[model samples]
Target: MTGTDEGRLHTAVLVGPEGEHRRHRKARQKAATRIESTARDARKAQAKARRDAEQAERRNTTYLPSAGESGPAALRTPGRLRLPKHQDTSATLAGQYPFLAEGGLGSSGVFVGQDLYSGGSFVYDPWVLYQQGLITAPNVVLAGIVGSGKSSLAKSLYTRSLPFGRRVYVPGDPKGEHTAVAEAVGGKAIVLGHGLSNRLNPLDEGHRPSTVSDVEWAMQVASRRRDLIGALAETVLDRALSPLEHTAIDLALRDAVRSAEVPILPMVVDRILAPNPADDEDGRLAEDGRLVGHALRRLVAGDLQGLFDGPSTVRFDPSLPMVSLDLSRVAENSTLLSVLMTCSSAWMESALSDPNGGQRWVIYDEAWRLMAYPALLRRMDAQWRMSRHFGIANMLIFHKLSDLDNVGDQGSAMRALASSLLANAETRIVYRQEADQLGSTAAALGLTGTEQKLLPGLGTGQGLWRIKDRSFVVQHQLHPAELAAFDTTTRMTEIARKISDLDVPSGISNDQEES
Candidate 1:
């Protein structure tokens, strides 16, 4: 091997195929770069196309018109719907909330009227409420100003209940308004006045309960007589009888009873005025009973005479649908009225005690007058307390809620008793009242501010009923017959007529009236 040959062999060989391979490799690299560039561009274009399509779709989308846009579209076209804000108490709101109102008392009792809130019939019965445990006491306190239709509501509630086998007893009707109602319901109204033939003998054996035996009845009669005479003395004297006076009354009642089988009031009075020497162990017996005896003498000889000094001409038939003691003629005499009520209460005691006496309503109209007398007030309180036991419902009607304030002093026992009558009664029906009376009425009833406001706006026959824990605004509806029967404004509208006047049309005068 030569040096030139060795150098050539050691040096690189420049072949044409090598140059072509380098060019081919470069071309392959260029082709790969071009393919990658084209794929990247294609991807970029696809992304742009998708973005453009989305933008076009958004541009073409439709939306509801803004406020005041003109087109044939619904009136609801608006930027944002709005409404006026409303606010009310839960009590008033419960009434306004159409679906949230009370379901109402089940229709199992006497029909009252429409429940303004629930928009359903409002029916109430004491027995029904008692049976359902809605009320523990069956008594009612109805208060309203004159012309508010409280009387009619009371009349309707009781009269409508007559068909359900309940009887009514108005122990003292000062206005005689219940006289017609009593007669209309096939009941009796014992109208006792100075000149009337109706007499109420305080000493007569009143209605006897079937549960009472003969000896027991005699003892009860004796005890009732003694208590009645004592009460009479207290009422006439306007003070409680002392112990000696009570002893004297006992002796007189015993002697009177021993002498006559059915002794009258005069005999008891005579015996008290002149006690027998044998019974008067103390010479001061007559002197101790002098004032009491003379006080009781008023019923037999004084201003209160002729009413209780004789036998009971009219009987207290418990089976009657209604019985009212009409004291309208004596309403002007408060003491006399109280005396009559005392005797009447004693007379009613026997029938009320009857186990089979069934359900009854004892109404006390012009209750403010009755509450003034301690004896009568006590009697009423007892009846009210025993209302459930006797199966009776006592109704107290007053001209206004403030009448309770006049019952006695602010915190006196009489006042407490009177207020208790209201407290024990679960059903309190209040009608329209004067604005000035709202505070007292609201305070007495524990009414809310809204209820207090509602009172002044209540229309005729509209009432607010607070039953137990519930409250109701009721629009009392009356039939035409009831309206005519309960009309108290006849004197305001009725024209005076002569007996000799011929039948004529109402709108006709001497010329038009004669027609």
Candidate 2:
């Protein structure tokens, strides 16, 4: 009985487990089918939801309803939502209107009053303008009528530039207006005249640039002396020297140099007139140099005496803020003035070429006097041409553009050179001109009709600045100190003050008293 029970139990266990396995398999298969169906439904629902979203988006993104069309939509007033046109002052609109105003000549340079057009501070600096590609030339030509404040403007330009490490070289202040300015700016003014004992030996080896080597300096001095002597002879003779004359002058200069540590014009004149035996063996040397010697002798014994007859009494200190040759004492004598300018120009040449000299303002005040002499004009032309290379800004001041006509004959090379000065100077400042000067000034400056009209109307301390192709009507504002320092009408003002000081009657006013 136990054996049969054991067999049945074993069979029952195997069959029972197999039946359970089959039931589990059926349940798992049904669960998997349900899961598959549920997943299929979920996928269908997702696709429907995605399609609904797409339809909603497309509906929402349809063409904006037309102006007339009404709907529960963003009420965009059709036809661009026009508003009443509005206007406001530029000062007020500056916030709304960006970039309408000039960003200004970047605030890096000197403050030169305000721009009448832009209604903002106008700044000017030749170096800054050059760096910014606004100007390729730094030389300036300033023209204005008498009592128009052009002189004040010129003085201000250079004096203001001094703080920026610039030096001023007023080669020839014929009226001596710059003497006070020179002394005021911590500079020296060399006043040479008939009795002042300020002898300016033209042969003096003037300032030698610190950067030049001994050899280069020697060559420069030799070349300068040779050129100077020739220029002097030409100035006196009123013509360029011949090659033979040049040779004779060169030989005389060499002899003078060998004879003294510092040669004088008298020595050169002596050597030229009374030739050396070796050089003038055939007497042709003396004949060739005869005219040049007599011409140069004018500096020593001729009417042009006392100035260049001896060594320089004063040294040209280029390191100073200003160096002005005050020629007022000798203003009546044109030859003496020309000789002094020539010597001073030679004295300044080395400093001008000095790399360490930084920036300089070479002001040629009363340029009319300078242009009268061909030698001086050529020298000025050379300085103007090389202004950029030497890092100097030359300012040639004139009473009017027509003053150039007084330089040389019509269509002459001197006139052309004078005109070239205006051409080379990219900056032209026209203060105030008479009505008659309008056409010539306008044509010479290439001023527009609008600009031409502005010349005559310019007031005191106002200038029409034509810088490179850009035009600006600037009202040069000076501080009280500047006005006091640059007052050119002091003589008239003093007379007025004296007239005003006169005891006025009970009913009379200061104006009446002045009148």
Candidate 3:
């Protein structure tokens, strides 16, 4: 039974299996066709992309003029040959009037945003203009209002002078701005007055009284009483009275002091007033009585001894970089004292006549007052006269242009004189100034248009420096301590302390303490 049933089922099963196998083969064929279609599509796409790229390359490689010809040779064609109307004119103009390129290196040895040029000629680097050696020495007028930092520029120059081994001298006033510089540079500060003699121990470490000549000169300059100064000069000069017979009076006086016993001023005065028994009708004495009287007065009076003796008013060391003379206390005295001391120092330095290529810098802080003294003007002139020979440089600092106006009818003359002094300087540094004042002074100094425009806008410690052929505007930087030390109150306190340390007599101590 099972064989018969199995035979029938087997036959049916074989038929079903054959049917399933045929269906499976059809499905495999359909899948193979779809795979071939996908590959064909991909190959077609790749061929199309390559053809498009080649076509684009061909198009790019081909260049044609608008007239439809190829290359520069096609320019000769009529349509392509049209020239611009102003081509020749533009070419000619270009040849004659060249364009100035901006943003390039300037002649001043600095790179600025733009190179200044006039008709193809370069102006200068703004920084180099300020650094040029034009306004470095004495007589160069610094005109600016308070807070303009004109004084700071002066101080910066003084500081720079130290590295060069330059000697700087400043007068001490209560403000003592310059006096601080002297102390910083290890120089002397001289404070003189009635009780100052006692309070300032001439025997102290670095203390000494000023020379008799120095004292007289100080009296002449600092004496508010012009009559007193006039009398002093007359008395001092009278012993050698011949108008044409000029003597080396300073030298002669110095010599007399070396040999004398009494105070020099009194002896000089007495000799001048003494009637010359040998003189005849003519004012001239037969045997040079003026010389003898001068000698005798210098010898008898303590003039030379007073100057060279203990308690020197001015203590100086050539090795020290700078010397500051405090004259703030000398306000009771004439402004003339400052002038005399300054002039005398310059004269003495010149007299020493050492020329070993070392440079000496003498700075006058608050130089405005110096203009009042003719002797100072003369000394300034003398500095100019001797600068080239001695390498001595003078820097005169002032608050405003008006400070130089005290020269009276010779105002213009004085201006010219000052200008000459400025011209001799190798560098001119100008900081912020009042617009009107800066404009005028810049014009006078021959600053260019760019410099004139930029000067008033300069920031603190920023300035214009001019040397021989170059000019530049630069921002000067200083140490924080230096800035703090220069403050007015700080400076005054320092000078007061220095004076107190002098250890003069009680009276002098009291006077200094009061100061």
Q: Which stretches of candidate 1 lie over 4 Å from their true place?
A: 1-97, 496-515
* Cα-based lDDT at residue 401, candidate 3: 45
Candidate 1 lDDT tens digits, 164-216: 99998888898899999999989999998989999988888988988889999
TM-scores, all candidates, are: 0.80, 0.79, 0.54
* Top-scoring candidate (TM-score): 1
- Show where candidate 3 strays beyond 4 Å: 1-143, 160-164, 171-174, 198-263, 279-315, 336-352, 410-416, 489-515
- Candidate 2 has a TM-score of 0.79
Clash pairs detected, candidate 1: 508-512, 508-513, 509-512, 509-513
Model 3 Cα displacement at 249 (Å)?
7.8
Question: Cα RMSD for candidate 1?
Answer: 13.5
RMSD of candidates 1 onward, in order: 13.5, 10.3, 24.3
* lDDT tens readout by residue for model 3, 315-382: 44555566565555545545334433542343244222355535565665566665555445555666
